[model samples]
Target chain A: MTEREALGRRRRVVAAVVASLLVLGPLAWFWWSSLVPANASVMDMGYPDTGGGPAAASGHGHEPEDGPRVSVATLTGPSGGVPDVELTLTADAGPIEVGGRTVAGYTLNGTSPGPTIEAVVGDLVQVTLVNRSVPDGTTLHWHGVDVPNAEDGVAGVTQDAVPEGGSHVYRFVVEYAGTYWYHSHQVSHAQVRGGLFGALVVRPAAPQEGVEAVAAVHTYGAVPTVNGSTGDLRVDAAAGDRVRVRVVNTGSGVLRAWVPGSGYRLLALDGRDLHDPGRVAEQAVLIGGGGRADLEVTVPDDGSVRVRLGSQSVIVGPADDAPDGDDPRSTLDLLTYGTPTDVGFDPRAVDRRFDYAIGRRPGFVAGRPGLQWTINGHTYPDVPMFVVSEGDVVRMILRNSSGQGHPMHLHGHHLLVLSRDGAPSTGSPWWTDSLELAAGESYEVAFVADNPGVWMDHCHNLPHAQQGLVAHLAYTGVDTPYVLGGDLDNTPE
Target chain B: MKTAYRVLAYLVATGVFVQAGAIAYAWFATLNDLDGGAVIDSDWEGNLGHAMHGIVGTMVIPLLVIALLIVSFFAKFPGAVRYALIILGLLVLQIVLAFVAFGAPVVGALHGANALAILGVSITAAQRVPRSTTTTDASAPANAVA
Candidate 1:
């Protein structure tokens, strides 16, 4: 080859080498960076633990020194003659049998929907939670009961998780009477789905004479169960008996409850009774995840009353009798159900109004690729902190455009449904801690900020919550001493 | 050899515009991502933009190298060969600058700024190529330009 030709070939070779390096260099770096562990703490990711202190040795952070302490002594009922109901619950994690299927799950008192604790209004309910074998710690969050801030059971926030072999006591007076539940807040996404939950019923002062049953609905390893049993749950009742079925949706999906054999009244919702609830036939009630619905059914003269929750049936009569026929699509709309009553607080006098628009975006979550859940277009750790002062009436416009339903839940307060899809609610006072939102749906809810604490307002669909569908409802003058994604592996979702 | 050179020039030129389009789309997607204030699951656009930018950005390297190799063989298009080599060098520098930009915002801005220069040089080199063999024959002798 000539000298010029050799020089020309060398130039081409050099160009190729440079080009190859240009392409491969960045790719190699990206692969290397992805493999490296994320050294930053949750607080470093723009969410600082303003109320900072060293995390407790038990893997749970302590509340700020100035924050209110919830002790067993302070949770006592008023002196003299108030009936006190006390119980002990142990949380265990292992392979457990449910609905004929042995699945791995966390359990309370050796059962999935732990024992139901029943009490009357004004009764002091004291429950000691003992963490026996649950690794990663556990704390019982009273789902709907408005307990003291310290007894709220949010690990690292309200209280540190009760370490394994350690115990904590939750005491409060049953002020309002209705169906509520308790579940773990530590690693809640795994623990709650694994079955660390139970139902709590507070009866009214004047107890009505009737046959009552708590239908705690949960999904154990993809199987729908009612009161820990799959298929039909039978309760024998005479023709004239008034049967109250309290349906609790513990899973992260909407559950439709309907009585196929008898007409039923929508008695209560989210632990609050409806005003003059009227009887309705051939309609189902949709209960949001982490929400509850109480239905009263009158047994037929002979045949069984089949109350179906999702695919599981609760037969409230003879076992062999056939279920009555009705179109399941004829679902009851609770927004206009029952007589309308004064909600006491004027929603128009809102102190703070915020728009919570839920959307989905394809992005990196903790350096991983997937479609992530967003609140107001921002993913978790970058989500909005809906700030309010104590006693402020806050109104939130929740719009869902994410192509799926999100059962939005707020801790520490129950929001009253003002309107849905721009239509004003004309029914009884509708209150909820978990409000279900369908895709393309909008809802306006208002709540008085009486409870002062840094509370989580997030999607109750625990998986979505983990995918960044979470935000904080921070009260002015209140801060959380806890940090997320630390050594404790405190996954509040 | 001249025909191969022309084809590679055209391909590299097309790739330059594609890279430009990808970068433009990425910029628009980033804007959309920023506007996603509080909306969940809106990161798809941003992620798509990043992927497109990376893919097109990496693709430019080999396209430029092939154009350089083919143009070098033509011998008459010495200016085209020089431009191709310059673009390849810029691309390498741009990749390094982009990684550096992760830790320094100012460097990132420079990385973005250098991309336009690379595009300009790529297009210039593609324009210098003869549209057909007839044009190449009608032009000056191979040793004249060199």
Candidate 2:
């Protein structure tokens, strides 16, 4: 070819190359900036701050030194003395009977719903957990109790999982009188679903005279059961006897509990008593997953009062008087059920506010293909780090648009439900560690940052959490020495 | 011979554009997947992005094969042969860069940058094809090495 022609062709090629780079350079920069911020690394997303010690406050864990004096190592329980009430719980994995169905599961003390340990307020409750045959090991996490960081029982975080034939003692004072439960924290997705949980009811110092029954509802092999019984759990009650049914939902979904033949009052929720609970009839109380509700009902004159849990019944009187057919009653709305009372702190003066919108999108997680649950439109590891200083009154708005219900459970602290959707709560103070969110529902909950630790706030649906529906509520100065996905295989969900 | 060269160039250029489109789609899918904060069911989007990337990346193998066949058989089109070889070399480089990206994600930027160059060069090569042998002879030497 001619020299001039070759030069012109080369010039055109150079011009095209320059033009392409000019266009693509800016686009690449924009994409990089959007996906990875300039100052933040992928490590900032969910990796534990490995710097260690109290001086390693990098604004991620624990507030600055000038902030509130929130000690992370301090225990919330009583300072001294051996545990007043001691109990032993042995975890075993084998075929167990649940609601008449023999299924492979892990159980506590040879039973799915382990023995209910009763104690009075002001007593120190100590439970020695012995891992008998659980291959992956086990650690008991008091689901709603705000114990010290060391006693939280998150495997790899607070402490290592108790291997087979090993034991761990959890000692904490019963400061509050209400219904609570404990479950395995190691590989909890499979352990909790396979049983390995039990009820813990702490009564008031001056106990009231009544017929008390604990109805621990769970789904075994897909069969709904109340107190491990599939059918009616009969509790003999004389006429005029006041019955208090502590309904604890241990399943991964919301459960509806109601008295079919009598009116009842909701006394407490999540271990906290409601103020001036008025009587209500013909409505079922909805309890979120991992939540508890205490209902009071007086036995009828002639027949029985049946407290229906899910599809099963807890007959307070004679089973012959139990009503048949479906309960056509409407569900009760707890947001406006009882008389309003003081919540102590004003929710109006919130220090920090955050909106956590739960959504779902098709994507990949660690190379696996599926639809993933998301918080605020981002998947796990990329989820929000809700930072707060100690003593700060924080308000969080949870919105679910995922077309599915999520029982969101927050660790280390309980929150007061302020409103549902947009309506303000007018009932007695409703506190919850696990809040249920229906599809297209929004709830606003507020809580003080009293517990200074890196807490996990995730869906109670363990499988959903395994798929990535998890986030962290991080205090400024508290850093976790734990590493997820390490050699321990710690699946905290 | 001129028509055969034209067809092969057009196919290579089309492959380049298709690969570019696939990469762009994958990039956006990855963005959507990453933006899905704490969602449990959002993994499919990321998997689809990787699938598109794999499908498009594998497409280059067949495209390079066709270009090689054109150069081997159509000895008259020397210019088209050179362009085909350059494209084949770039495809190999792209594959290497992609593997390197797994270890050092920062290299992904270079992988993306190289993709634009491949697209541009393929298009330029396609545009250089002569409409007829009379025009081709005027622009190039006779009996050119393929």
Candidate 3:
């Protein structure tokens, strides 16, 4: 062979080697950086975002110079008290009947929506979760209940997941009367979607005269259902009777509820009653994922009133059949719906302010490549740790530039909506645990840091949370004993 | 190396056709569902066709294009690197257009057009490999001595 040919061959080999390195180098780095340690503490996982607060805050525990440290395990409710409401729920992995099609899902006591646990305000509720056959383990999270930190039931954050053949007890007092829910927090994204949830209703202390029904909506596979049934929820009521329907959105997206043939009043949101809510005929209430709306309607003397919940409906009146109505073109604006009243504390007197700006970009999360959700422009394990102190009035601005909507849920506390899109709330103060933010929409909300614990603030679309659209509302001096992705495989999505 | 480049390039071209077919099926299925009283709200996570389109567009085709680029360097074909680079650039633009289409749906037209550009360039890259392979086969005896 000629010398020139040999030189050309050598150069080609070198070029190929260099090109391969150029292609493979960054991919290797991304995969390596995305690897999360099996047993890692949430305290050390991400960077601390102090929300412009003092770095050496007085009560913070991790600083080592603080007064005292409180482990998350010891933040329990009264342990040795007689419980007013007690129930044992057995969680098993099995088939759930959705529209007569048996789909593989988890169940409690052999049923999907389980049993509705009802209690009165000021009553102590004790729930024992017995894991019978679930392979990955499970824990029950009180959706809207402001239980103690130990009773919050977040696996890997507040407590360990109950393994198969094991049991865990959760005890807490029912402080407020509202519509709430309980679902497994371990592998929550998959387990909650697969029917491991039930409704929790707490009635007020005063005696009320009305017909009440809890309509917990969930989607089993492709079929949307209300109270584990595929068809409309039929409530037999006499003419001129008032039916109060509590609609709880347990699924992954926003649900619209409207009553046709009769005017309805949105009595409550999340779990708190609104102040002087007026009647509306054509407007529909938008319930974010993991949110609740209580609707009251007085049945007309003519026929049935159908409470349309998107595809599903709640039929209330004397007749069996109610014509389905088209969905309302406009949603009921909560910002201007009811009369304003005192919400106890002032929202302008804020202690610490935080900005949660959500966006989306192509990136790697846990070693997988896709268009991933981001919190404050950072992905999972690199997200913000929103630090706060007990008794502090915390104001947060939630902005969604993520090209889609997100139902943001903050555990252990409820936020009062102060403003939306820079417009102050002109109606009743909106109290909610799950606030839905559409693309390019922003909201300013405030809440008191009454419940002290490590809490999850994240998108309630379970799959989105699993994709790392999560942050934490951590109180000062609170630390958890458990770690994520540990020996027990605690995946608290 | 020549064969690997050709196979990867053709696979990328085939992926464009699959993406088009899957997106078409997704819209048609959505229309059928809407007719059957299904509400297409924020809760709707699309049908199986949409899932196929997402997986192929994001994961499958991008990997194929990267492999084709690496193989082009060692394939010993004229303009092989240039064609691979052009296809890669088009694929990157295609993804950007897809994301932009989410907020402004009119950009979807550009996304569709870019997919055709990727298909044409990748096919051109694959077609060029065979002619170079024929030339190499004829000169195989001289290279064997080296």
| C-alpha lDDT (0 to 100) for residue A239 of candidate 2 | 86
lDDT of 3 by residue, A1-493 (tens): 6998678678768867887788789978876777777887777666777776665543333455655668889999889989999999999999888887889999999998988999999999999999999999999999999999899988999999999999999999999999999999999988999999999999999977879899999887668899999898998888888888999999988898988656899999999999899989877888999999999988778888899987898999888877677877779999998989998898888889999999988778888777878888888878888888888888999999988889999999999999999999999889999999988999999999999888999899999999899888888777788889887898989
Candidate 1, TM-score of its B chain: 0.67
Candidate 1 docks at the CAPRI level of: incorrect
Give me the candidate number with maximum lDDT.
Answer: 3
Output the lDDT of residue B62, model 2: 43
Model 2, C-alpha of A353: deviation from truth (Å) = 0.9
Using TM-score as the measure, what is the rank order of every candidate, best first?
Answer: 3, 2, 1
Instruction: Please report the TM-score between candidate 1 and the true structure.
Output: 0.69
Error of 2 at B31 (Å): 40
Backbone clashes (count) for model 2:
37
Reference-based lDDT, residue A432, model 2: 89
Candidate 3, residue A197: how far the Cα is off, in Å: 0.7
Q: Which whole-number lDDT from 0 to 100 does residue B105 have in model 3?
A: 91
Q: Write the per-residue lDDT of candidate 2 for residues A240-317, one digit (tens) a residue.
A: 888888989988777888777568899988988988899988888888888899998888887788888867778886
Candidates' RMSD to native: 12.8, 11.9, 3.6
**Clashing pairs in model 3, backbone N/Cα/C closer than 3 A:** none
Candidate 3 chain A TM-score vs. reference chain A: 0.96
